[model samples]
Target: MLNKDTLLRIGCFLREQTGKVAVYGLKLNAQAVYWHFPKSIACFLDRDINSGFFCGLPIRRIEDLPRNNIHAIVIAASLSAESHIYARICDFCDSHGIVIYSLYSGKLKAECLGKAFPAEENQESELRKAIASHDIVSFDIFDTLLMRKVLFPTDVFDIVEKRLREHGIDIPGFKNYRIQAERGDKRHKGLAGIYLTLAEMLGWTDSQAALVMREELAAERQVLVPRPGMGEILSYAHDIGKYVLLVSDMYLQPEFLQEVLAENQLTAYDELYVSDDRGTGKGEQLFELVRKEHPAETYLHIGDNAIMDGWSARVHGFDSWLVPSALQILKTTEAANILSFAENFNDRLLIGLFANRTFGNPFAVREKLVSVKSLPQFASFFLAPLAAQYVLWLLQRAKIHHFEGVLFAARDGWLFNRLYQAAAEIMKLPNVPPGMYFYGSRKLCISAALQEEKALEWLKGHLVGQTHHFLRECFGFLPGDGHIPPAWGEDTDLIWNEVVDKKESIFARSAVIKDGYERYVARLGLKREGRYAFADLCSQGTTQCALTHSVLPNLYGLFFARYMSGSSVTMGRVETFLPQADWHMLANNALEFIFSSPEPSAASVDENGNIIFEEEDRSDKELKLLDEAQEAIEKFCHEFFSLCESDGFISPAIGHFLLSMYQQPIFAGAGKVFDGMDINDNLMGVRVDCLLTNEK
Candidate 1:
């Protein structure tokens, strides 16, 4: 419950202290330790042999712990587990009369150490006073006023490589060429000049280089966006009657910059300056020019780089604030370990930077600690962004593809449709296009399409040496209607009638199935010749194909994931992290667990298409957990819609990243998300055989 001010005070206290400071948790993989401590750290306090502290730095054990001269010891373990560990450390520190800094107990985000940037959330009064004291303020354009949606500045070269491939020139090492070959020298000029040098160096044709340059330029337009609260800063300066100038040491030209600014509607600056036009950098020459032009005024520069903004401005007699880069902030946190997979610091920086640009670091908890305890709040924090993306994509896809409507196929699609409706309301699109939760499952669709000879053949095709019991269930036989003995291997090749030996019974059953299916469609009140898309979580095109081939011919599939008939040829390139059918049934698990399914899988319908209830009261434990999860999910959708109504839309890149975290291993990871969650059958409480491994 400690506020950032308290944490900042502790950080300042630690920073002011002099001497050989030691970090207690760095050797124990305590992340974000450096972010809250001084640069004078001299040793680590861990005795574990397996700890990654092999830098030849001074290391300590509990028995040999220094009681003197070691300025301060900072606790960097997680907030949840650190208190217990700190109690022992605290007693030792108190006895030794040594200063102790508990980073886990205080807010690390509030500390302005390392690459941690203080956003407009803090230091507002100081910024305002500094602006008021000065007649002019210069802001670094990139990473200050505008943020690029990438980790490293060089990562943009990946887009250029993509462009090269599209133009029939696939360079294997183009990213490296852009990162390594095209910088820190006068060899290349202009924005595409580097690509030109890269192309020539790699013996690529001028056409290929031109294509790369074209793509790089286009990528800039797509990538650059206003950082959160940037416009407010600009407006605050303008309102105070302070002259604002945009400055950068970038290769992109002023004209292109102006175009990009205008494209984003960020033309509030009094002037713009770039190193490309000046042929010199932002150290002194740029300031000299600005000072001469705007005489008799104090200049206050706010830029991301300490050297480029701070040292340069102070040396030139102008006031400056070293606004850390958002990318750098991400880099620090990624180092601190919010991103579990970020092993290398540089790689963490890249991902952190990308995530910042994409979703403004969705997991950036200012005060709240991230743990299973905060999972109930995940709706607004994690899932709302993802849900918003799906809603927008559905809308755009429906419009562009000229589909009449999308039927959110039952089970997962049912929950998706409800959320979509909430999103539509939030977006103020009351006249939402044709979209509805079409109550249809694979079982329902297949059964409705049965009675035809083709369906009979399709059913036969599905039973490839499988049990006759499976075949019976596949045809929606009511438990023990037909006597089909189980078989294995080549024995399954027996004739269908011979296996069942109930032709009269099957004909009567076929009539009931056909009638039920016809009634189901009739009850839906649909018109003919409607181009409908079957929407599902991870469709195998079973429901889509069955409905299209047997019932309706104008059905297309819009699914999160799609499996082929036998091969891995997807219906389209599905952008998802769905566990494969050969490994785990992700869609099946989602249908039963993630989505708000109040009942079991759809059983056979009555002749009138009324859903026949296979009544089984759910266990109190499963119902409580499922309802809690579903309620949280629904609340998250509500919050997402509210944000949309207020013109706040989540990005798809961020959404995709969060969804990736829900992969099978991650979802069921012990002590992580969904640690105790189980995969269960809604009807019979039967654990899906494979998932039973994680049940305990």
Candidate 2:
């Protein structure tokens, strides 16, 4: 809220007070004044002004302020607004030859600030001098200079047990003690106590037990790996002229600790403290030793165990830090107490860093890494897809083959035969050709041959006695004479030339046939395919016999075509006519004959000439006739418009047809017309059109 003028005035005032000054806006009022100051005035602003009120100065209004030679306006706003106000003040003071002093809590002392201070150059020089000074600083090794519990208890116990057994020191109860020791249960007693207990149980002499214990202890100690970054911190401290020391309540000898540190590439400390060497646990005595060793320098000790290291340091008047393992620290009930203690005690700070078993260092779990907790989370992860691709590549490298295909029934009975017959008819259709057809149940019969005849024969044999005999039998018609239309004779060879063989290309061909059929039906302007080549095309195999009967007139053309071809496609021979033969009788008789029915007229024909009263009337006669005609019209228009829309296929006559079809409610009215026709015909034209045009 501070304006440019107000900030400039505040900066000028600060410059008068101190040759080089920094202004801090502690609240909203302070920020308002700080922003209007000149660039020469360094202004620091608090982020959250509403939380509290400002009581420092009365430089609120920018207009009434005088422009003086103020050097800085340190906007000491609340922590929240510090960055924002600092940026604004710095930018406003940029061109005025002003140096803005931005106070950062992360780097600056929270409790100390003064108007007159050493120059920036002097501060930098002092910092360098501090770094160059050599001083011995003692640090507790466990949970301080080194990590705690590097190896699992089981791992350490295993090594100890193996060594003890090799030394011929056997005891039945040793295993239980090892288990308890590995778990770090102080209540279970220390390893030294366990070795004595085992020696007593095994009736061994003190000298023999001690000898075996030493060997097992050596083996166990070898497994205690140091924490990551501990050595680095120690080395860094040592490089800065700080003498390093390890103080722990460990039972290992000083020599062993030194060897371990040297192996881990750590600098040798000035002194080392182990319970065995110190003759006591960590306490005031340890601090007394450090004080005696380094009398002239300030010393700080850091460790994980609060009672042993922290309390001792406090009692001895030494600066201390508590750095605990992430897991153990989380489990501790005294975390709040430790944090409160750190807050109240200026010299101590409790630092928490995460460490896992495999990765010993405290590395941040990035937001991106943490996000991969669920399947969808993994899927959306930026690198997950790439990882999956890599895995797939690996699988390929391993030469892992897999099966990919569709499953279908392959029975050679009624339904199977019908399926085959349908497939065969589809293949036999002009411009239709054979391609891959899969058939089987859970246990499938696979064939990759291109010969339609061979495929059909294989299907028939494989499905003949199968549970899905009916389905297999139906599919069997794909290869044989039964599948072929009557127009194509048994001896007539399949013409495989010039037909596009790709499955997709074949499907496209079917779409073209379907389009042509629909357009031809539409041109006739009939509500149904009552009398067109389309109806016949719709009624080919036995599966479509009932369908053909529904659209009687359309099937007439197909029937005629088949009959004329003399291809021996079977239909019931109808030699006898009814006593009273008429248009209705002839139609009913033809349907009955085709279906192999003992009697026609099992259902009645309605006034609209539709067979509307029989459950057995699956034939789409009326609906097919009407819908086919409507669809044909729709196709003609769609094609005509498409052609017109294209660059070279424009025809006014076609356009007129398209316009006429578009205007006439053929699509909307077709539904009504279909409802009036037979149930079989209800969707025949639309379905056929969809099939032909590949609309579906």
Candidate 3:
């Protein structure tokens, strides 16, 4: 909405002006008359009797108007009737001794009148002001602003004749082809069409003719230059706070044109409007941009072609000045007429032209801040961190260690229990203590016996047994599975026989194991006498419980891994998932590290009070170890980051990894004892390993 001050200024100008003004015919023309004139001095006159609704003022016959006291009359007709009314008014004014003044005349007394009319209003007053204010005004770059120059207009005819003479076809009226080609070339529609006509005249094939035309046109385009005064005009526009807008019909690359503009030093336009970059023709796009960026300012559009720029402006409601070269005036008159006609017509013509045209909606203007609708629509950015935190909370409540949903596991207890028992027996040997054993289960513990020198040998033996058990129970295989029988041989069968069948002797030998087994069975409510009791307890406690717990620890591990990954993916996700938490942690950690350091000595201070900080140096050994540890941490973190970045089974993978990290024997050594440890000795090996491996 325009301010009342603008309206009042416009109204004052209308009251003060005394002239026969020719207003292009339009719906708003009559209203503009009211905007410009006092009610007492204004009169509405039109030849069409039915225009009363639009005129607002009472219709008066033009012929019946008294000649006295009417020194000047403004032609407030529709654009379609502008020329017709202008001619009529000019003749009438000349005969009646009245002076005829164009609406665009600079002699108009009111400078503030132009200020009142907004450029976006697309009124004649605004166009005049823009033209008067700016020295250079640019139009469409392609057809309107430039044309292909012909090297030899008459040569087109000569070539056709030469080709015909070679063919020896002395057909009557053969010279007519040359005449037509020359005429077409003069219009500068490009030589391709003319060449096609020449091909027809010479009776050549389409391909042969097209090849010749393409070659010629390509050569011609290399020497292309700006139209006369175009560069100077652009500089002038920039000097006077105007701009050179290259609103083209064809899609032109911005980079190429930008280079051109830069080379010419004509890039200082307050703004540039390019159709290819901005999306479409200058009609609605120009008006929409003007409304957003240059509201209330004046603008002038100068162009050679009329259809692309001239009519586009008139129909779409932007003020346009058509400056067709003197030679092009006859060809552009029809376009000028169309523009004039569109001013009086309703929005129907504009709508029809824009229909099926792929362009951004003119009404969808850019706003400074988010809209109320967007506040809810884009709430995901704000709520994602909260959602992740809630997920973490749920995971903690569940007390789940690992989640292995993506990997396949047998549902039966008997099969899984056999596997667990086999792994446990292998781990319980002299060298492989219960603490050293690690199976893919929570409750079962494996051990082995070997000298310190045979640690690797003992590990190989344990791996063989574990692999055999996995094949038989988890995969439901028999002894003939090649690697299984050979690796297990007789030792595994003997251990299985003694441990599983002779349970009483086994329990007497290891009371801790017996107690753990009993407690596990009790927890699962398995009947002691039943054959399936042990299997049920093992499957329920190790497989089911371990699988459930996998979720929590795995998720935690993934979070930590991503934090250490150093990849942008983790950082980005963390930004979304825990924006405030991440920022707070980073800020706090950096502050603590910075402030905790010793302050620089006074001797190191510069005259400006700036501290000349000394760089901390580290030994090669320390640096090497730090680099290695950082690399390992980075690698470990990358795996988690990769999982989070993917959409496939991400939650399950994260849960499992976290669970494994927390529950693994490697971490257990740090005094963070978990469930299922019977005595303090069970944790000795883990603690020793952590102490040896600790880098800090």
Residue 442, candidate 1: C-alpha displacement in angstroms: 7.8
Model 2 clash tally?
86
lDDT tens per residue, model 1, 324-412: 56655544442223455433322333343334532342223233222333334333334444454566667655655677677887666
lDDT of 3 by residue, 1-696 (tens): 223443454455455555433222334655665565535343555555624533455454444344434454554443345435545555555555543332222111212211222324433343445656743344555423343222222322333333334347453454466466645442233344566567766786888666555443333243233444444555556666654455554333465555555654446455556654565445334535544555544445566445445544433334466544322431222222222222211111121111101011111111211121221111111111122222232222222332221111221122222222333243231221111111222212221111122322322343444433432432233443344343333345533432233334323332333344344434444333321111111111223222222221221111211122222332111211222222222222211111111221111222232323333333344334333433332332222221121111223222222222222232233222211211111111111111112211
Predicted candidate 2 versus true structure: per-residue lDDT over 139-220, tens digit per residue: 6775455553322234344444544555575544555664544344333234466556655556778887687677666654
Each prediction's RMSD to truth? 15.7, 30.6, 30.8
User: What TM-score does model 1 achieve against the real structure?
Assistant: 0.48
Q: Where does the lowest 10-residue lDDT sum fall in candidate 1?
A: 107-116
**Candidate 1 structure lDDT:** 0.57
User: Of 2 and 3, which scores higher on lDDT?
Assistant: 2
Provide TM-scores for the models: 0.48, 0.31, 0.22
Looking at model 3, which ten-residue stretch has the lowest summed lDDT? 356-365
Ranking by TM-score: 1, 2, 3
For residue 686, model 3's alpha carbon misses the true position, in angstroms, by 99
Candidate 2 worst ten-residue window by lDDT: 344-353
